[model samples]
Target: MSILYVDHEINNLNSFKATFRRDAEIYLAESTEEGLKILGENKIDVIFADHQMPDMTGLEFLTLASNQYPSSIRVLLTGNAYTDEFKRAAGKGYFHSYVNKPWDEQQLRKLMISNLR
Candidate 1:
């Protein structure tokens, strides 16, 4: 499956590629605009986005993506402790799941596999 990860941090994007490159076809973007462009050019099966970004929140990006690519599963990666915001976004059906920053790789892999199935 093809997965897209959107984050402003270069290190996080690199680390995600290192971790998941063997598992799936991974695409990385540093901004929501770049991510949207990638989405337009590719058939992404899953999307993982950081909650906080310079231009827009991950939720906003995901909301836009969900509107355009309803088949792609969306996930939020957040380091913050704000469960309320996460819950609100999830409740609105913007994303399928939220993974805390510094996430467990195994758990994330499992989640992705299950969703893909």
Candidate 2:
């Protein structure tokens, strides 16, 4: 399976790729636009976006992605506590799930693996 992870932080992107690269084909992007570009060229099984980004929020990025790649499992990564917006987004099926930033590598790998199956 292949995964696309979008984050503004270079360290976060590097860490994610380092953690999950062994489990799946990992693609990293620093912006929503770049993520979209990667999406256009790849067949991604999962999409994970950081909630707060310089260009667009994760929700906005996932919204656009869902419109184009409805089958890809969408996940949001945020450092903040779960808020009403997240609740609403979850209810509306904007994303498949979320992960808190500073994610536990093993748990996140499991989540990614489980969704692919």
Write one digit per residue (lDDT tens) for candidate 1, span 2-106: 999999999999999999999999999999999999999999999999989899999999999989999999999989876787788788888999899888899
Number of the predicted model whose lDDT against the real structure is largest? 1
Kindly report which residue pairs in candidate 1 clash with one another: none
Worst 10 residues of 2 by lDDT: 104-113
lDDT of 2: 0.91
Model 2, span 8-72: residue lDDT tens: 99999999898887788999999999999999999999999999999899989998888899999
- Where is model 1 more than 4 Å wrong at Cα? none
| Cα displacement (Å) at residue 113, model 2 | 1.9
Q: Give the clash count for model 2.
A: 0
Cα RMSD to the true fold for all candidates: 1.0, 1.0
The alpha-carbon lDDT assigned to residue 15 of candidate 2 equals 91
